[model samples]
Target: MFRNGYKMKPIIATLAGLMLIVALACAGESATPTSKPTNTPAPVATATSAPAATVPAGATATEVPVPAEGPELTSMETYMQSSGYMPEWGEPKTGGIFKWRVSRNNSNFSPNMSGTTHGLFNMPRYGSLIRFDPWVGFTSIIPDLAKSWAWNDDMTTLTFQLYEGVKFQNIPEVPESYNGGKVRGDEFTCEDVGPSAERHVRPPKWETTLKKGQRSLWHLTGVTCPDGPLGYTAEVHFEVPLGKTMSALAQGLMVMLDKDWLEWYNTEHPAGMTKGTNEAYHLGMGTGPYIPGEFKSDIVGEHRRNPDYHRDGLPLADGIDVVILKDFTTAFTALATGQIHVMGRGSWSMTPAQVAQAQRDFPDRITVHPNAHLFGYGVGFNVGRAPYDNPKVRQAVQLAMDRDEWLLLRDAGELPGGMKMLALVSGTPWSYSVEELEQMRGIRDKLTPGGQEDVAEANALLDEVFGEGNRELEISCMAAGVEYVEDCLLFADMMKKNLGIKVVMESVEPAVGTDRSKTGAYEMNSGAVAASTDFGDPDDYLLPKISTRYNANSSAVLRNLEALKVNEPELMLWLEDTIDKQSRELDFVKRHAMVRELENKIYYDLALYIPFGQRMAFPGTGPAVKGYRLFDLSLYSNWSIWERVWLDE
Candidate 1:
């Protein structure tokens, strides 16, 4: 049986360093790994130094044969071993604030209601059952709230043995009901499990409550917490292989909310010093390293260390203060002047030039982590819309998208991280090798002769599809944030110049961007997705991203898929089935093969999203900012890292 349990575990702003830009040498590295919590737990991750693991940043993979039987790898030993990604940020110190920056702020603090940007700014306040290790090889796992877990003989029923005496934060100032008169609620017990498992982010039936749970499709049938909210153990039952259940639990999307907190939130009673702040934050709490402090919807949000936290020796810093810098240039200035201790530790907070500048100008004042990060970002097409609905049209647009040009235009084609392949594989064990990508059409080096041939083919496809007169049509494009708006402009220019499509670009608020994307309200939009953000499961990202199901395809987030389904029924069914098969396959090697038939590749064939402006997080950190790294590409999970970081100053 394939049953196992294991634990583990941007932004450019400046153009200050000309010489450093030319020679982006390795900063430094160590292998100490993340600090372990005596109380809290770990997450779902990649296999070990085991062969198929580690798809080098800009290199190809070395294939290994799969074993026919025996036991598959579990997460138990994944965290101890380092993938040589650790940074020697000095000994851990205590008591200082981690001042970080974001392009925007989050409003709705609810799990299912929030967007990616929300995680970027406030994820540290949330804790999951399992969390991505804050140290190296984020693709692997460790424990978080879950003390340990196990699957049955067929790998269907999963159970979690909870850590005892884990108490929820007690901010008497924030509650929605007339219960618990201004005191810490109760210990996180078994009763919290039933409501969490019964209601989640995934879709079909449960989706009605949480419409966008990591984008559609699930295998969980029921969850039975026998002892209710008072006990510790929780039993969950699934209809198929334990897929969505694992990712959802580990990703923090489905958290074990305090039973009383849920009651107050559901009943709608109010408490707290400030009504708005309480509603957005304290109303729902968790067993995390930090507590939500003073919050300004757009300007800033403060996270205070949880003194009564369940985890011991955690939250090395006293707190985290996340502020917003409208654009990359402004954010870089903040980092340079030490206005913020770290920028973009969670999201693409800065630019490549700024990273080089920070290290060059403030060599001792700042610490630049030159390694770790693979961003899958670009422009997503709404396939449910006409013209975009046509596969040939989609393919043509993708063919014309010059990934190399995007790099040049966006980051001057020079990144300290080097030229990295994004999207499709996203630096995962199951990702296509650089060698294989070189042979593909939409990907591959755009400066080469083969690339020119691909462009010629794209023009031919466009000619065949649009004829001549209607070639120049108009389309609306949108994106959120200053960086994304810039990305939108570059993509719009490329599409107009190459595909003869006139584009209108708009930079909307972050919330608007998500709602529009979720509803397919635009023709194209700036996009990025961390396939491993939720969990290292293909089902976590793929199904909702590319599925033909109405409102399921997040890349398109189209309203009606009836047109695409009618036109390509076989392809749609196969894509859906393949996604399902991969989710069910527990063996690493076999599942890798199924993830990509690799012949046509879904990203290229479906052409719903064309990845351009690829990025490797170039986060700039002040000297005092130590023990910090992106929890995941999209900054959606691993908020637990806050527990490991300490402000050296």
Candidate 2:
């Protein structure tokens, strides 16, 4: 699970010195007014204590006790009992019904959607204000539905508190969906946590989830709570300093909705709600532990549990269906004929040689569960087109192919000459060592085709960047899987047998390769599985693919920094002042030596993307499932953990 040694627990090694409390630097902007209101406590929901208190005037807070039926253990069952993945097949048994599939078809159940296939249909119907310690990494952050929080001092202001019996999710076909007809199961207040964290920083449904230069809630400005319903308390306010306000509220679309059923569905669907065409916001209504039932879209969805599931005894299944196959060899042949008990090894799963031939065709009724794949696999380059913006044609396509033949076409020939990755930190915490990524450079060594699969230095740099045989290009396997058609037919047969080039191939459809890699249409694609910005830091894995505010370089991996802000405006202002000073460095050995000095100048002096291979996550399960355990953290690693699973019989 943690792939060999890499330790750090104490719930995320105490959040890098407990989030360096705050040193302040406008991490990409929005919290203006530096100081005016020193203290304004007039909005109470039950404040008047002192087992240690202090607020907005030098922060303290602390109260927390309430353990009547919750917390006997949970911070994901104490990170599965300190990562030994819990008392194996014991405890956690309530009911069963946990089938699974989903390799596509989820455009709603909005926590402001942004794929993980819409977090397996809205993380079993929403609930957040922190989560992910599901087996530590993603720098931990627990406390969902905020039962305790406080920061102030220099952390702009944080606050939280609420958990007083968290409710919401009664839905009877939206019985006049709140604010008026009120049938969305109330009482989850502090006014629904400051408009659900200001709906991920406002604007007509946040321009459908912050795409244009995504700053993810550009430093959230306001959100104070307290007014009637007697104090659940929220507070919030940020201007971006505490490590980009704790990795922008530890994102998974930063959930927590139901503010009167989202202001009565944005006032009766006023030209909003698109994904899954608003079946009452895709059967949404959270306070999670499951609720939405029988939805359709890519066909078949359901969920039930939540008999007021504010943790007590818990959701040990009794509902969680999901179907939507869309091929991965027909969802690994419906999770190998047991008709699905769990499949999600996401990025549309399967292919570790179909999870090692479904663990040898279900020996002891399967149960793979390998994690460490937020995402990675690369080779992109459309770099403002034409001979891939020539750097000896991206160093003769990384010395004419050979990431161990893309790990033997992703493990089909089974561990063909053992895997090897060039970068995209294997299983992060800045993974290195395969003898330190085979002595770096363009990984496993190669600079301008210096040699690492040299193919005569890649056909003398494709015959001095296209002269003799006019080395062709185009390689767009964007969708359809089987490891993107065996890495586009073995990277077009190793560029026509080591750089006589002429390779073509095109497959399209992951929404047309995310809009033909953002309009610089294809010249070479099949990159970006680079997932994991769900907070774990290495600037959440290299600042959103080399940030320039996420233009993400017109797509097939890294290029446009506004065309180097106009041909090297001092290297685009020192790559935007050192990725905004290493994303506001909250000192983890100085942000790991400023992210290994900007990942060795973006993987060996701006070679601009080519890593290839690493993103595994198996998660199989079926020996009467039991309290299934595989939450290698990012967005609690899929299949919405069927509310802590069940069925030991």
Candidate 3:
């Protein structure tokens, strides 16, 4: 999100001649800081005295009541009437450079090695097997790379036919022995995909593992490349039924790489060679709208439009220039000054005052897009640790603070109702139950009953768990120096006020906080895990929070893991099965019930980490910009689509 602040100042002119010169200099150009007053007008009220003696002179005159005028129509209605869906149209005039400010600089360009943060930019530049069409609510696997595919009834065996006309970006400057010269597009076949999958699945080379002992894992059993009726096809067989397998394949996996390029680079650099890093970072290629042009650590990474891209009409921008500014203030300043066009990755965090100023100043010049992310922000306790190790103590902590109070204090006014607790948002299925949520109120009542912190109840619970007069039980909280930290502090203060248990707050750098959480260094952490968008399976939430094997990085409860494993196979297989709607829904509800039942055992944190409100914002642009929809996913990738954008005269 974009935000700016305005300082209130009184204007006084010392010299009229100098002021006049300043005014003339500013004319016909963008407003400068000293040009105009930023404050708005206040309301004024007028008083009227009643006529006394005048009535005597006009005794026969009668008073008439004037009819009230109805409220005027808003400007939005006027615009809608003036223009249909083709608002101010001709065709969408396209062609201009759209600049964006990214919060971090990414060094990893290799799609195979790029993690989620880097992948956001790379995905659009590099095509995927399947694509998400939000409007259609389904997945599309374009035959640009994969010609076609066949799936078995059991969904265990899947075959993909490869397209002939495809080639990686070619660098003519490089020697022929380097295999940097262009290869015929038709030479690309099914043989390429199998090896890529094999490479991904292979041992210590890549971190992703497919093991048999794990029933719920995303384990691929076999992958084969064979000649087929359509030329050649790659067959992939999974150990278990995965309904999201196709979606995953379309989303991330199956990005085809030139086998020759990979082989040559590997041979030239060998393993662990420093020169290999340069080849991987700079010369690596893909068949996307954009190609990696240059990368410098902690500085800048540039992506240039691909001239040989296979797509019919694509890659709107000439190039994308991404600069990493770890300092948010600098990034925000750059955005306000129009130095950058976009904010890459993560939601924008802004003060309420800054948000108000941006709305007032930019108005139509900026756009704000609010997305529902999967992660939650709340207090998570280590169930194995002291105090929280006891279920009653956990319940007491849940009851101590009203979530509404915390929302008001931390979010300024935003509520958590809009936030998604489980994988799905509030309106969707698998969200929290109304009755169960109301139970929280009852829990609060049990603590204080008077809408205040109940010190007696907290102390009693703590004393019962750790014996009376033992206020020395240590509970460590991990917090960042943000609103989230304030929320944690609020909770901590309430715990002390109501329960007599002293809680310590440990504020750390965001990166350090993440590392600590991953290493299980804190007794309680304030954050959440993000689930996949457009996918609403309960397993996404349940497994990650409770599965010991899957969430080995977390210090989740062991009993929760054991209980989850009881119906693990049933839930896993049922999730992917192509069954009737009724049957599918029933299984989903059953799985949810099992997880909810285990949740009562104090398996996870009492307060499910939910967002108070969306923190990210996109500012609007001027009339010169067109064909851009705020809050909508770019037809291609977030970073790549900027090229297609063009400026209007």
Per-candidate local distance difference test: 0.57, 0.55, 0.43
Considering lDDT, where higher is better, how would the candidates rank from best to worst?
1, 2, 3
lDDT-better candidate, 2 vs 3:
2
| Backbone clash pairs in model 3 (N, Cα, C under 3 Å; residues 3+ apart or in different chains), count | 24
Q: Report model 3's TM-score to 2 decimal places.
A: 0.67
Tens-digit per-residue lDDT, 36-121, candidate 2: 32233111111111111111111112322221233355434543453435565676567767777777666555565645566666
lDDT of 1 at 589: 57
Model 2 shows how many backbone clashes?
Answer: 3
Candidate 2 backbone collisions, by pair: 45-230, 45-231, 433-436
The TM-score values for the models, in the order shown, are 0.75, 0.34, 0.67
lDDT of 3: 0.43
- Model 3: per-residue lDDT, tens digit, 344-424? 343543333333433444433333333333344557665544545455666556556445444344331121212213222
Candidate 3 has its poorest 10 consecutive residues by lDDT at 1-10
Please give the range of 10 consecutive residues that has the lowest summed lDDT in model 2.
Answer: 1-10
